[model samples]
Target: MHRCLAVPEIFSEILKDILPSDEPRLNGTLTSDACHLSLEGRPVVESSEELYQTLLALACTCKRFLEPSLDALWRTVDSFWPIFVALGISERDLEEMITRHRNPYYPRRNPYHPHLSDLSEAQFKELALRLIIDADYNKAQYYLSRIRIFKLHAIPSALLWAVGELSRKWGSPLLPNVRELHLTPPLTKDYLIFCGRRLVHVSAPLSADSPSLTTHSYPNFDSIYIPADNTKDTNDVVSSFIKNLPPMRVIDAVGCNSMPGTLEVIAAMSSLRSLSIGKFPDLSSSPAFLSPGRLLPCLQELLIGDIDLDLCTQLLYALEDPSALRQLHVGYLSTTGATLQKFMTTVATRCSPICLTRFTVSSNGPRRSADAELPYSSKIQPIAVQPAALQPLLPFVNLEYLNINVFTFNYDDGFVESIALACPNIVTLCLNEHPEYIKSRNLTLRCLYPLAKYCPRLESLNMGGFTFATGPGKIGVDGLSRTWTHDERYDVVPGLSLHFLNSSQVGVIDRCLVDIAAYLMDIFPKIRYVDYHPLYFHIRDVREPGWNDWK
Candidate 1:
């Protein structure tokens, strides 16, 4: 019943189906030879937009294509906002779409519409609410109000007002989640008062004309860091702020100026566990507020920067029971031989037996030149530590860290040996020698050899301003020319000598590594993490004879 058609006949049939039957024909000629050809295989859609246009075109073409095209068009909508604007949709459209399919992705809406800047506030509010309700509440809160996380600069009042209103209405019971809150100048007393109860962590920058916004009932804060920019108003405001704080755990008054009643109030806060006071101008003035006896009884960590040694000793002595003081950091502004010895002796005796886990002291004065000579022996006191004197520090066997700054030393071997013997369990040790002393005569390896012998558990060691030699003959020399040409190889100690590196000089670093590797291969076998600072070379246990392969 069916007859196979030729190619020409098939082409004519396709043209007839595509064009209208009423169309005029050219000379009634059979133009099937000029007809367009269909390619083999399936049709390929170009992109999402092209697919959507194709579906829309199909839907307009005939009733047979309407259902499939509409289905494709609806499924191509990625977000509610785009679909809404595209379809000229309203809030009711959103409601219907959400009701039918409850799993639509809704993007955050921008309150200010770019296309309709002239829209009234009521319209903006309605649109904002609709968008807000569709978005996940947890994510919307970040943009909705209270906390301003981005842009440290000041915020405009309109945005602030909107955020504040939203916060008061919907952000109650739960505090705003912000990492840092900085309240600066130009803010009124009412603004500060309103933010005080909601903010849990705050940094207030005070100015001369700034109002003292200290309220008796303050926010439930856990930490406060105040910056004292050398201003009278700042000092006054800081004092007032501390007076009104809830029982806090940490307070950092690192650079605040000396306030009349500030220190006294801080000392009385029983809940403070850690405190730092740095760069105070007058330590010897003996203000009524400086009472360590009342202040530091329960402190677990205390850091006093750039204070006179005498004042430091006085403060340390004030803490009659320093059992709770586990960490101490002091920066010496004034140091002398007698004062230094007195401070060290006091710590070794009075505070050593307690749980003092870390101790650090630094002198920030300029280093003397290499050519500068040390004071004469007649003016220098003999460096000696009697055995009975060190008995008090035997209780510090549990200490894990120790750092000391030595400006002048007698270069006596016994003194270094005593330190190494006293703190055998130290894991981290930093010994900073004055540059003048390192460059002076009598700087010896014999003095420091005790460290490698005594500190078995030491994981990190820093020795600045010193030279390293290959053999015992050049141990006491000031220059490297005396130590480089030794014939015998040195054994590097493991666990004993694993992480050995010098940040001093190239010649010193190279020679030290050569000797250290030899020592490790010959004497200590468990060494790892050897760093040669000048060469920027690091060697670990995975590679044996690590340095020889390097060109």
Candidate 2:
């Protein structure tokens, strides 16, 4: 054994790398965001039984590794089973308690909780007390004291009864030092009792019948994550819970429904730094219901998933002082080009330009069947996507990522040039036009010239639909840059950063595949992948020399 192994910092880092933080799991499926609950405390890492045994052996074998080994072993646990096992509870009793308490309300999903018929309230309390009395208190405390993060997947009534009894007996919580807690479905009011004085954050689900948590539950609470509830009319329950909570620093209600005062309740939280909501209620008609308070003064990131143009405009109005905001994302159920233009105009006037960096919006409605398109009115005129729609965003000089997906957009070389000059720091620019609802698109292959010329930092580009320029004369970069500025003419070569080119619905020009490939290579010398439509392959053979040359 080396002397460096005795160093606590080195040993802890090694242990953490070997047993990383536990990835949140919902019925065995991994979530999309691993660090979703990382705002309040450290990530809860699950140490496997085998690793725990190894650490125990090392601790028993050597004095230098004893304290560090024990600390790593009991830092975080996936469930409460290990605590009972450590207290000398028999395996037979544990199995019986779990099997008999399978919840009947959601038998298919939550099979570890009790049904009403299995045990009456008194009977459940009695059994929980017996188990608690039979277990060794000293042994349980030895391990529980070292635990910092705890996750309860399923809470049986008996477990809650036992926890309440233990808290009452000792005059404090069983896990008194825990800082972060995570819970799964079937969440009820009883779970709030576990919020010890030191606890700072909690993550749980919200259901229609679930009870609200009071402000007195935890004195140090700072952040919360309420997973979306699938039940009907859950807004009232969620709103009541939010209304009762103390001022929070972060609130993430991604898939939850919107109520009348939901935004108002959130806007009143002056300390909020990050806020994400599923939708905004339509309050355009009743503007008086909203307060005139300074909303989210410390806000940094705002994400809205599904909203209409009217409510979105109202939300901007609610943000009286948005100078601190950094990111804004808005997704629409459906909207027209005129509405989108008006919304952009509002955003330009409302949101912070200097601090904002990322702006993303999606307006195309949900997918519909082919037969469902009959009711769509052709009387509504089509609007061609122009540089003016994006001109308002040019004030955000620090913008790095811009993504826009709407019904239709007519792309041209001038449109590309406008974006390239407006946001020179942009890293990812995606101008996706909905393929289902096609309109006139005049973009040509020459549009790539401006991107490679002006946006030197750009790495990815997607022009919805485009065609190659046709002519009797040769097509080259020189002809495209004839009107370039004196400063722009210095670096006439392709950009070294761009690697991905996404161009679909490519219309062939004079069957000049060789010239097209050469021109693309000249503009984006570092291109690694080019995405084309299936129809492109049908028009031109995949085995052609032009394609092979590009590869």
Write candidate 1's Cα lDDT for 210-276 as tens digits.
4533325344455566665754545556667666566666677666554535666666777677767
Candidate 2 per-residue C-alpha lDDT over 366-470 given as tens digits, one digit per residue, 9 for 90 to 100? 211111111223433344556678778878878877777665666567777788887877767777665544435556666677776667666666555554443
Which stretches in model 2 have alpha-carbon errors above 4 Å? 1-77, 86-129, 132-134, 146-149, 284-293, 306-311, 334-339, 364-384, 395-397, 412-430, 438-551
lDDT, model 2, position 153: 77
TM-score of each: 0.54, 0.64
**Prediction RMSDs, each to the true structure:** 23.3, 9.4
Model 1 vs. true fold: TM:
0.54
lDDT of each: 0.47, 0.61
Worst 10 residues of 2 by lDDT: 365-374
The weakest ten consecutive residues by lDDT in model 1 span: 33-42
